[model samples]
Target chain A: MVKLLRSDFRRLWRSKLFYLGITAVAASVAFGLINNVHYKRIMLNLEIPIDNILFLGTLVIGFAIAIFTSFFVGTEYSDGTMRSKVVVGHNRSMIYLSHFLTTTFAAVFMMVIGTAVIVVVGIPWMGSFVTSCTILLPQILCCLLSIVALNAMILLLAMLIPSKAICAIVCLVLVMVMTNMISPTLWSKLEADPIIPEMSYTDSEGVVHTQPEQPNPHYATGTTRTILQLCYDMLPTAQMYQYGYDKIPKNIHLFPLYSVLFIGVLSTVGACAFRRRDLK
Target chain B: MEYVLTTSALSKKYRNFEALKDMTMHIPKGSIYGFVGRNGAGKTTLIRVICGLQEPTSGEYTLYGISNKDRRIAKSRHRMGAVVETPSIYLDMTAEDNLKQQALVLGLPSYERIPEILKLVGLENTGKKKARHFSLGMKQRLGIAVALIGNPDFIVLDEPINGLDPQGIVEVRELILKLNHEHGITVLISSHILGELSKLATHYGFIEKGHVVKEISAAELEAVCRRCIKVEVSDTKALIRVLDRMKKDYEVISDTQANIYGVVVLSELVLALAEEKCDLLASHEQDENLETYFINLVGGGENG
Candidate 1:
């Protein structure tokens, strides 16, 4: 296992993908920081909270992580580089694990560094409104784990998909759509409040009555918050982020545990399928 | 002597296409085994299966007396190296870095062996120059260097000289010979280049349409491909009479021609034929080259 990891690390370090990803992450963070300052200056009322600003920056960083993971693994698969490893008598399981760990670690490291740069740049602009180091530290750690989820999800798709271009495009789309769809559900579950309908109401009518003054609960309440929330709550990513947000009970730490277990299972299944697949 | 690598009824099917069909081969220890075939004749498929890149649909193979079904087959395979189809090196890494990666994969204790392996493949001074900048020959040498990292006793090379210049081909040929002669590494080389293979191979297996049609040693093949004096005689019956008196080994190719597989004194044979009332229209010494022998063995077709 160590041997396999070392090989993958060397390959990843030598490839242009690593440098390109780091540059991309740095540029995106710089852009986000500059854009936040400009937007704040343009509209004095648009007071962006430092926590939300950093959160949004890390969210963009998550997408970058997803792209990096896909390309890193996808390039090898596309070019038939894995053939040598397979031919060299290495265990296929070890190969998958090595790539998975290396890519995931890289994603986390890039995001952390990118986030640090953003925070440093934001200190003068945001003044005292900047996020506290204490809160920001854990958020950064949780943000890294969240980005790992994105990495796992994207890596799984790249392994299963045949075409690199198609795999990468589809992975980004799936992650953007699914993460958007899954986050609010997690927020709703952790906060114990619905994401839509504007207001929760109780009527004091004489007989049993329902308030229909809200923005249609049937559609608005469940679209992003109800059904998908249940689904997201069942996922490890949702659980990990929810626990890290300090919204759930301490006992709910099991979510990250479940997340780890679930990701492990999915990655194993992906690796097995990849192993059985015929290289073109 | 026990065989170093043997396949018994080994077969691999990719969905509906049967890539290999009961390919049973025996490569004796220390022998330079030549796996000869045209493209899609299951050469690469067999190599992939033996290297564990793909599983066989049916049948088994043994490495150094260890059966594929046995748990110890992996341990047995640890002593093997292979370069399948193309050079499998990271193009962005230098040749030395690529070797290091391979060494890492094989779990070598240190990077100490990297220098020696690089020297062996004649790539010692390619320090920090990435493989993408390498010439095709350099890339190929690096691939061989990567394969030799663990000092395996058995090596499989698939068309190692397929895309080389004359000089590159000579370099690879000499390297292969050195490996076998000095290092005692048994090699399985598969190629459609029968000429180059004929020079290096000690044993030959001719595969056609996923089947081993014939397997022969170098000596047997040489005997089968005997050099002969080809003669086109005006009167073939007279030519046979002349040959019968001399008691030489020959084959009657046609009614008007024959090939005599023996030393012939031109004047004596002409005199003998004249006495037998045979008119030798044309005569020439013919040595069977690999192309002719391959065509004779596997049926003739325009080289495609």
Candidate 2:
């Protein structure tokens, strides 16, 4: 397994796709920092803070991880190099585990580089974290775990799907859907308060009227709310949103556990399926 | 003779389709074993199972006396290498980098053999050229070079020459021969290209419908696939009478043609045929080749 890791990492360093991903991550973070500075000055209403920009790398790092994981593992299947590894006596379990380890390292490396760029540039532009740095450690750790869990799922798809093109397409589509639609939808529904607070408003007249509090129809209620909250907590992307944008997710303390469980479960399933899979 | 690889009732089934069923064969040490089969005839499937890319649905196989079920089979697999379907190479890396990656996989301590293997595969001067831009033949040779890195004594090549031009085919063919002869490596080549296989294989395993139809050495197959003289004459009756008088084994396939097996004294037979009023229009030697033998064994069809 160590040998396989060495080989895979060697290849990973040489892979153009991997480097391209790193570049994208670094640039995205750098651009986000620079854009924040511009937005702060241009839009006075935009309350952009260093805390918001602190883990901003977490949001876009998943995209880089997705592309790199797809091509990295997908190439093994597409180029049939994975078969060569097996042919030369490497155990399938070792091979699959090696891939998981190697890609995880790359994912972490990309995320770190993105974070470093943010830290280096973010402080100068938006000032230091308003919240205590140590107080933000839990969210920071959750962001890292979510990044890993997201990579684990993408790696799972890339390993199982043999066609490089198909695997790549599927991974990119999955990441886009999760980040754009599913995570945001879940966050909104989970964040909505069940009871609408009393509203005092002036509507087309100079007289103030107070509206009675009532059940918020859009808020997920009862069992549905429980399931939706669980999903929001479990999904790495949703967790990333909570960490990067939310002040502190209500489930901040439990997100890492969910991410770890997600990682453990997905890695086991991926390795087992990969071990039994037939290569052509 | 000792064998490098052996299988007993090994079967591989994918859902309802059986790629290999009770398939059994042997690859002798230091011999070029040609695995001949038609498309979808389980040639690649058998290779995949033995190479450990896929598990057998039932039955078992062995490498160098180590059973597939044994934990030590991986150690046995260390003595072998394979290039299944296409050349298993990272297209993004240069030829040298690819070999280095393979060496890392094998846990080899040095890159000392990289140059030698590249030279052997005739890719010594292809520096910094990524495999993706290499020609098909070059990629195939690079694959072989990668396999040759660990200095394994046995190698498996699945359809190694499937897409090569004539020149490319000859280059790969020569490489395989050199690997087996100079390095004394045993080669198990799975290919439907019988003509090409015939030129290289010292032993042959004919597979059909996931079954090993037969396993015979090249010499033994030569004796089995008899050489014959196909004669097209005006009167096969006269030809038959002359042949029978000469006590030759023959078969008359058509009204005007006959295949006289074994040796025939041409001038003496012509005189005898002339006396019998048999005018020989055409005569040619038909040495039953691998393709012919394969067709005859499995029955001729679109597969042939």
Candidate 3:
């Protein structure tokens, strides 16, 4: 397994996709920070806090990790380089584990690149974090765990699907679905105002009318809110979306635990399925 | 004689289709074992099973005396390398890089033999060109080079010459011979080309419909192969008539070619053909062809 990891890392280092991923992470961070800061400074004449955009890199890193993991690992299947490994006596589980760990490390390493860009490009434009380290550090840690979880999920798709093109398409589509559709929908449901605000209107005849406050039908309350919040926290994509929006969950302690479970369960399932697969 | 690989009643079924059933064969150490079969005859299936790419549905096999069930079978497999159906190489990498990657996988102590392996495969001059740009022949050679990096004693090549041009075929053939004769590498080559395999194989395993039909050493096969006189005549019909009157068994290959079975009296045959107003263009005494030998063993078919 050590040799396998070493070889995989060597390929990762040499892979153009790896460097390209780092560039994409930096570009995404730059894009998000520049777009936000430029918009606020020019139009609103307000300097945003570093806190608002500190997690910007993490948001882009999630997408970068998806594309990188798919192609990096998918190359083995596409090129048939995997056959020689099994032929030379490398256990199938070891192969799976090596890829899982290698891609995880790659995601973390790209996170570092993203963080550097945020500090270099973002801190100058927006002031330093107004939130104290005590509060800020855990949020960053959750972001890392979330990215790792996302990478592991992508690795599962890569392992099960052998065609590089198809695996890449699947990974890209899955991330897009999670980031764009599922996470935002959950947030919308959970963050609905509990009661509608009172409104006043004057008719054309000059008579004033008032509408009393009422319970907002769309608001998720009690158990429904709890389940929806838990689902949002459990999903890596939702975690990244929350980070991007700078919204802390009600139960902030649970995101890391959920990420770990996602990593463990997804990898275990993937390895078992890969073991039973009849490889070409 | 010792065998490097031996399979006993191996079976593999994909859904309801049995690719291999009760297939048994032995590949002796230090011999080029030719695995012959038609398409869909389970040749690749058997190779895949032995290479650990796929598991057998039943029965067992041993490599270097270690059973497949034994954990030590991995150690045994470390001494072998295989190219199944196509060359297993990273097309995006250069030949040198491909070898280096394989060396990393094998965990070789050093890269000293890499240059030698490259020269052996005739890719030494191709410094930075990736495998994607290589000709079919070079890619095939590079695949063999990757296999050789581990310095394994046994190598399995599945249809190595499948799509090579004449020049590529000769180069690959000579390389296979050099590997076996000079390096003493045990080779298990599976191909449908009997004429090509006959030139290199010291032993053979004939398979048909998921089972081995026969296993014979080259020497043994040569001794059992029929003897006949091949003749290219101006009129095969006249020659056939003369042969029938003489009570001899013969087969017509074409309008002007035929093989007379058994030892023939050339002088008597010529006089008989002369009386029939037929001229023999050419005549040669040789052992029955490998294709004929295979057809005789497995019954005539397109592959044979």
Candidate 4:
């Protein structure tokens, strides 16, 4: 197994596609950071929080890293190398595990480097604001976890789908679209109800006047909040967004634990499927 | 002794089509076995199955006397190497790196033998040049070098000479001979190139329609090939009279044709033929080559 992993690692390192992806992601992250800082300084004229800038910059970097991890696995499947791996007497389960580890390590490596570069370069530019280790550390760790989870989800789709490009594009588009489209409406539905019922006595014959009665807006029930929290917790990025950067949840810690479990389960399922798939 | 390799009614079914049907083969040890068949004759499938790439639908095989059903078959397979269909080398890597990767797969201890392996394949001087830039012959050699890792005693090469130049083919032929004769390795080589295989094979397995029709040693094949002498005769009776008088070893093929095997005095034969009122027609010698022999064995058809 060690020997197999060594060979796979060497192949990955020698691959031009892997290096090209890293360079592409690095370039994009640097460009986004430089542009974001310059615009904030000139246009807004307000003191920009380094945390906010870091968070925004890391989000874009995370997306790039996540998409590349998913695409790499898909490319291996389509390129016939995966079949070659099977031919060499390595177990299929080991092959999937090796690939998953490689991709996750690569994703985390890229995310850390990108985040470090942006924060180090952009923080000094801030006039008087000091970066807090308390917030920055957990935020960066959560960001890494979020990217890992995102990669797991995308890799699951990649394993199921035929075309790598189509899989990557569809996964990225769906994640962005679904998170934006569904989260807000679901949040609103979980929030307090605006409408109230007014009851007054009415005379049947004379039609006595009835006065409008205002009732207090009712907040979400504990059960409804728990369900919403469970849904958010099932997604790692949602969990990170809810509790990351030293922010504690007021209602429940359902988001973080659920998302971690969700990501772990998804990753395992993808690995198993990949292990059983016959490469033609 | 049990054969080094044996398959019992081995078969493979692909979707609605059966690629191989109850095919069984026994390959003895220390023989350069030539697997002769046309393209798509399930040669590759058989190789792949032995290599553990595809599962056989029914039946079983044994390698080194261990049954495929045995848990230790995989361990037995470690003694074997194969170049199935194409060389499984990474074209993006250098020849040295390619062999290194294969060595890693086979769990070699050190890089000490890598240079020797490269030199053995005549690829030691490739330097850092990647496999993509290598010529087709070079790539094939690299693939063989990769297979040679871990010093596997048994190697299966699927059409190793296919698509190579004459020089490249000769190089490969010499390499296979050296491996078998000098290193005591067993080679199972499959190819449509019958003539090339005839030069090196110790035994031949002639396959047709996914079945091995004949398996014979080179000595037996040569003996059965029938080197014949050609002679022309006016009449068989006259030829017989001449043959009787001269006591020559010959066969009276027909009234106009005969095969003379022993030496004959032309003047004496002519006189005898004249005395019997017989005339010589025409004579020519014939040597049956491997190609003609193969065509004769399998008969003329699309595969022939």
Candidate 5:
């Protein structure tokens, strides 16, 4: 397994996609910085948190990592290197795990580059951290873990699906739909109960009536809210969305735990599927 | 003789199609074993199963005397290397880098031998040229170089010379010979070109429709496919008696026909037949090549 990991890392280091992923992350960070500068100048009251910048930067970075991982792992099937590894006596579990680790490393590497860029440029542009170090540090850890969890999901897809083009399409679509649809929808559902504002109404006798603010029953509560929060904690994309908006959950530690669980489940399932797969 | 690999009633099925059925074969150590079969004749399927790329639906095989079901089979496979169908190589890496990756996979102590392995496959001068830019022949050689990283004793090559030009074919052929002869590495090569295989194989396994119809040594095959005189005689009983008395190897085809292996004197044969009151009807010289022998063994036709 150590040998397989070394070989996979060597190949990963030489892969053009790895460098491209880093470049994309760095460029997106610069773009984010420029946009923040423009927004700050135009609307002096608009304050962008460093956490938001780091988390949002990771969203784009996560997508870039997904694309990088899809092609990186996909080439094994396309070029028949996986079969070569198997033929040379490498265990299937080791092959799968090594690829997973290499991809995870690529994701983390890109995140590090993006985070560095954000801190260097973002600290000056957005002023010092609005949130204290105690809160910001944990959120940063959760955000990085979320990126790893997303990478694991993509790695699973890449390993199981044999075709490069199909794997790339599925991975891209998955990342988009998860972040754009499911995560945000769950987060929106879990938002605190809506506050209905006061309103005045005219009676038939020309008398005016005022109603005070009240909690909207239509908003999620009880079991529904609990389920939504649980889903938000479990979904990596939801974690990213929460961090992007600086709405760090009270149970922030659950994010890393969930990420670890996701990595375990995906790696287990991916290795089993890969073991049974018939290489063409 | 010690066999490097053996399959016992191995079978593989895909949905409704049976790729291999009750197939059994033996590859002797230190011999270039030619796997002769047409396209889709279970050649690659068998290779895939042995390489652990696909599992056998039934039965099992042993590598280096370790059964497939045994946990030690994984360790046993370290002695084996294969290039199934196409050369399994990373096209983005240079020749040396590809070899280094393989060495890493094999858990070698160091890559000091990579240079020697590259020179063995004639790719030492490839330098920084990535494999994707290499010609078909160079790519194939690089694949072989990767396989040779750990110095595996048993190598399986599937259609190694499939798409090569004449020069490339010669290079690959010579490389196979060098590996088998000087290195004493056992090789199992499958090829559609029988003539080229004939030059390399010391043994042959002729498979058709998911089963091996014939397995013969090069010497035995040479004897069977040797030039012979087909004689039509009036009496086989009398001819057999005479041929046996003269110590000749011959196969009695029917009551009136027999194939006399090796050279024969026509006057002596006629006189001997006459002595038994049998007359010679007709005679013709017959010589069979590997392709014709394979076609005949499989029952010649389009399907064959």
Candidate 6:
């Protein structure tokens, strides 16, 4: 298993996808930081919260990691390297796990590089955490955990699906959908929470009046709201949405626990499926 | 005789299709075993099963005397390598990097021998060139190079030269021979091109419809396929007597047809047969090649 990991890591280092993903993540974070600095300088209302920047950056980083995982793991099937490893007597479980771990490492590497860019530029432009350091630290950790879980999901899909194009398309679509669905803003919209206008309108008679928007009757309620909340807590993307939007869950540590559980389940299932798969 | 690998009653089925059924074969140590079968006749299926690319639905096989169920079988597989159907190589990697990856998979201490392996496969000069840019033959050779990383004692190649040009085929053929003869490695090579296999095989296994119809050593096949004179004679009883008296090996095909194994003087045989009241109706010499022998053994047709 160690040998397989070593070999896989070596390949990952040389992979263009890995570097491309890293570059993309770095560039995205740098761009976000520069744009935030420009907005701050121009006196725009944009609040560049460090936590929000990091968590929101995951949206782009997650997709990059998805592309990386798909091609990285998909090539095992496409190039027939999976069979070659088996032929050399490496355990199938080991091969599957090594790929998963290496993909996870690649994701973490990209995240770290992206975070570095944020810290370098974000501290100067946006200042430190908007919330307390204790709260911010845990939220950041949860955000990382969420990204790792997302990486596992992507790796699982890539390893299980044999066709490269199909795997990439499916992973990208699934990630995008999951991320979009998990966003707090989307949930808020769905819930139809009343919005209070920031600026009040003045009538022609010089009378000032403010009106709060009514809630949509179609918004989720009762059991549906509870279910969506549960899903939000369980899903890594939903957790990212919570952190990015400053709606940190009370028990944020559970996010990492959920991520760990997901990794365990996905790895076990992926390894078993891969073991029984017939390589052409 | 020591056998490197053997399968007993091995079978594999996919949904409604049975790729292999009750197939049993033995590959002797230090011998080039030619696996002969038509398209979709379970040649690749068998190779995949042995290489652990697929599991057998029933029965079992032993590699280096270790059963498939035994944990030690993985250790035993370390001494084996294979190029099933096509070469399993990373098109994005250079030849050296590919071998290095294989070496790493095998837990080799270092890539000290990668240079030698590349040179052995005639890819030493393919520096920094990704395998995707290589010709089919070069890719195939790189696949072989990957298989040769650990200096395995046994190698299984499924249709190794299926689509190669004459030069590529010769290179692969000579490589097989060198691996078998000079390095004393056991090879299980399957191919539809019987002519090429004949040049390298020390033993042959003919598979038809997922069953091994026959398995014979090269010498035995040679003897069976030797040049012979087919003669139609009247009074086989008289011909047998004359043949026995002349001390020549012969197979009686029917009441009046017999095949003489070696040379025979026509006049002397005719005179001898005449003395015995036997009449020679017709005579012709026939020499059978490997392809004809396989076709005859398995019954000639594309389906076989």
- Scored by DockQ, the top model is 5
Against the true structure, what is every candidate's RMSD?
Answer: 6.0, 4.8, 6.2, 7.0, 3.1, 3.6
DockQ, computed on Cα atoms, for candidate 1: 0.44
For TM-score, candidate 1 versus 2, the one ahead is 2
Question: Which of the two, 3 or 4, has more lDDT?
Answer: 3
Clashing pairs in 6: none
Tens-digit lDDT track for model 5 on B1-304? 8999999999999999999999999999999999999998999999999999999999999998999999899898898888887888898889988888888889999999998998999999989998999999998998888888888999999999998999999999999999999999999999889999999999999999999888999999998888999999989999999999999999999989999998899999999999999999999998998988998888777663
lDDT of 1 by residue, A231-252 (tens): 5554534543443332422334
- Stronger candidate by TM-score (1 vs 3): 3
Q: What is candidate 6's CA lDDT for residue B175? A: 86
Residue-level lDDT for A46 in candidate 5: 70
Worst 10 residues of 5 chain A by lDDT: A47-56
Residue pairs clashing, model 1: A236-A259
Q: Every model's DockQ, to 2 decimals?
A: 0.44, 0.71, 0.64, 0.26, 0.78, 0.75
Each prediction's number of clashing residue pairs: 1, 0, 0, 2, 0, 0
State TM-scores per candidate: 0.82, 0.89, 0.89, 0.75, 0.92, 0.91
Give the deviation of candidate 2 from the true structure as CA RMSD.
4.8
Kindly list the per-residue Cα lDDT of model 6 for residues B1-304, writing each as its tens digit.
Answer: 9999999999999999999999999999999999998998999999999999899999999999999989898999999998987788889999999998898888999899999888888999999999999988898999999999989999999899988989999988988898888889999999999989899999999999999999999999998898999999989999999999999999999999999998889999999999998899999998988999988988875664
**Tens digits of per-residue lDDT for model 4, B172-268:** 8988898899888899999889889999898888877777778888898875565665778778887887787677777766668887764555667
Q: Each candidate: what lDDT?
A: 0.76, 0.89, 0.89, 0.71, 0.88, 0.86
| Candidate 4 lDDT | 0.71
Off by over 4 Å in 2: A45-48, A198-211, B226-263, B266-286, B302-304
TM-score of chain A of 1: 0.74
- Backbone steric clashes in candidate 6, count: 0
Binned by DockQ into CAPRI classes (incorrect, acceptable, medium, high), candidate 4 is acceptable
Over B1-304, each residue of candidate 2 has an lDDT whose tens digit, in order, gives 8999999999998999988999999999999999999899999999999999889999999999999999999999989989989999999889999999999999999999999999999999998888999999999999999888999999999999999999999999999999999999999998988889999999999999999999999999876677989899999889988998999999898998888899988999899999998788989998988888899899986643
Where does candidate 5 stray beyond 4 Å? A47-52, A192-218, A221-223, B234-258, B262-278, B302-304
lDDT of 4 by residue, A132-237 (tens): 6874565556666666776667667776675778877887786665455554444565554654556667687877676676644554557976776566555655
- Residue pairs that clash (backbone atoms under 3 angstroms), model 3: none
Q: Is candidate 1 or candidate 5 better by TM-score?
A: 5
